[model samples]
Target chain A: MDPANRPLSPHLQIYRPQITSVLSIVHRISGAGLGLGSLVLAYWLISVAAGPEPFDFAQHLVGSPGGILLLIGWTFGLLFHFCNGIRHLFWDAGYGYELSTTYVSGWVVIVVSVALTVGIWLSVLIAKGTP
Target chain B: MSGRTSLRRVRDLGTARDGVHHWWVQRLTAVALVPLSIWFVTSIILLAGSDHARVTAWISNPIVAVFLMLTLIAMFYHLKLGLQVVIEDYIHAKPTKVACLLLNNFGNTVLALSCIFSVLKVAV
Candidate 1:
């Protein structure tokens, strides 16, 4: 047993929450979620190439209840990941180094991601004549 | 340059000692995604009511195929790095954290392979 391996530091719960920390966590969460969700995309692409029966099956899946939930979740994940990724880019650019800017961007990511998700679903509703 | 430094710049960041590799990659992917993602979304939109041949032909273009692969690959790689950090930060149990990290990488690899193969199969 090595000394370096012994006695680790306390985990995230111990740290007081902040905008940077929250977004950092959500960024990864949404990223992983979206990454997993890409399976649906792969299936759709392959089915598209395989022709109509396969494509129809894929469409049915997307139209199904569970599928719709997953689709909605994936959409939200994509929106959040995209928004947070942009905020991170600004941080990388060193423009949001200021704490106030950091907090503002964090809230912006949350609000905008939600907005984009609803806006998308709204369009879908309108297209379906359900709105 | 001195043997040590302070207030590290973006290009200089990495996992080691306040570095910026993750930061840079995230930014690079963000910039790359702007056009690539738009292209992707638009393709999907155009794909609405698209026939099988249309979808196949669209992706078969070498440029589109290459760029699409790049987009997915970058996305998964970026995701792996992001989740690795998340695991490191959040998981308190050493073995559990390591296991999760391994799972994360493995999952990404499998997904990437499936997606890439599916695209290539269509193209070829």
Candidate 2:
């Protein structure tokens, strides 16, 4: 088979940026991010089950500055993955077929994820009475 | 009048029927994940300050135990399907795709088994 002779779909590079495009890329990126993030969760579990010393060490790690950064990244990763998963679900259900609806949903995922992350942080602060 | 021959105009099967099956399963798994994942996340946060006994007891409860098992199965099952799609799209070679797909299942299964064991150990 002559591969060079095969017809090709229009290249994505030529298309102008669009919300759908961002959403499409982010969906995959966040999925990969969250996949890696699962390891942190597993580590946490092992620590918890191992006993006091391990648990305390795990806590300190999670509580340390570097750990906080990872936590923040993981939180956003989870939120982004969840939001995009919902968006994909909508598409699966046959909603958001129109370009406008697609864009709207894309923006909604972004906004909702931010709101959720903020809401979680707010709840944490309220619990600690720190913010 | 004799019936005329039915001429069915054939258009290209856009996106193919297999896609619908794939899309449907992905959505089904996604929907299944909603409540389970909420419980999973909230449980983790709640367990944040919980001691070993507290965590173990919570996990040991029959309802949580069963759902935790289901959660493991559903999560890895869902992950397998999602990763398979990525492999199919990005990796062109038939052998490579098959290898990746098989490796994905193997890795996910192993991961899921370990997590499930952890949960069961806590419960027991």
Candidate 3:
């Protein structure tokens, strides 16, 4: 049999989206976002090491409205990836393979990640308000 | 570094023997990040809107610096592994795929080093 001529597996576009499929793709999307977010984190640290001027520049960048929006987005991505990564870990441990369980856990990941993101942002808002 | 195409290499070798090692390390880093990232997020929340001196002081603490570096390392390692899988799964052209793979490795290493160095410079 010619390997080149072998039929390719169906791609993602062919499938009707389900909770399982949707969350699986999101896990990848959020991961990519966090990878970009890490760059911001790296710059924040580098600016600090560079001294006050650079640090202030970075702080201003992050504290600006656009920067704050980006941070909020990254916050949700971080929490979503964090929660969903735990789900992957559990599956790695040879547990939670049942279809019903996967669905339930998928919902749990979504809800928990959203809640955490909101909580963290609210804390940041409250913190800013106080001092 | 071999000249063989990725499809050819993958088909002939089956699992390539190191697949499990990659999977294992990915999981290890994920586990480490679980606590490390939580500590980081919580600390960031606590330090939100803090002044330069306050933020630097937090990073200057030896304990905080240690954890920060640890988190940076684990996060980048895990990210590299995850992105590798994504690229392999989606990118079909051999040269483009290989280029992306190299970028994934080198990019993660550079970022990780920069962040680690920043932590050390402030802490020490």
The model with the greatest TM-score is 3
Which residue segments of model 3 deviate by more than 4 Å? A1-10, B1-14
Give model 3's TM-score versus the native structure: 0.89
lDDT by residue for model 3 over A1-131, one digit each (tens)? 79999988887788789999999999999999999998999999999888988999898889888999999999999999999999999898899999999999999999999998888788778867622
Report fnat in order of the candidates.
0.50, 0.20, 0.82
Indicate the DockQ of the complex predicted as candidate 3: 0.70
Instruction: Name the best candidate (by lDDT).
Output: 3
Model 3 chain A worst lDDT window (10 residues)? A122-131
lDDT of candidate 2 at residue B110, scale 0 to 100: 79
Model 1 spans > 4 angstroms off: A1-21, A49-51, A128-131, B1-23, B49-51, B92-95
- Place model 3 in a CAPRI quality band: medium
Ranking by lDDT: 3, 1, 2
lDDT of 1 by residue, A28-116 (tens): 77777876677778778667767778988887777777887887798888888888787777765678888888888889989998997
Per-residue lDDT tens digits for candidate 1, residues B6-75, read: 5454456534753355656655667887677767865764565556667788889999899889888877
The worst-scoring run of ten residues by lDDT in candidate 2 chain B lies at B1-10
In candidate 2, what are the lDDT values of residues A25-48, reduced to their tens digit? 877777766666666666766665
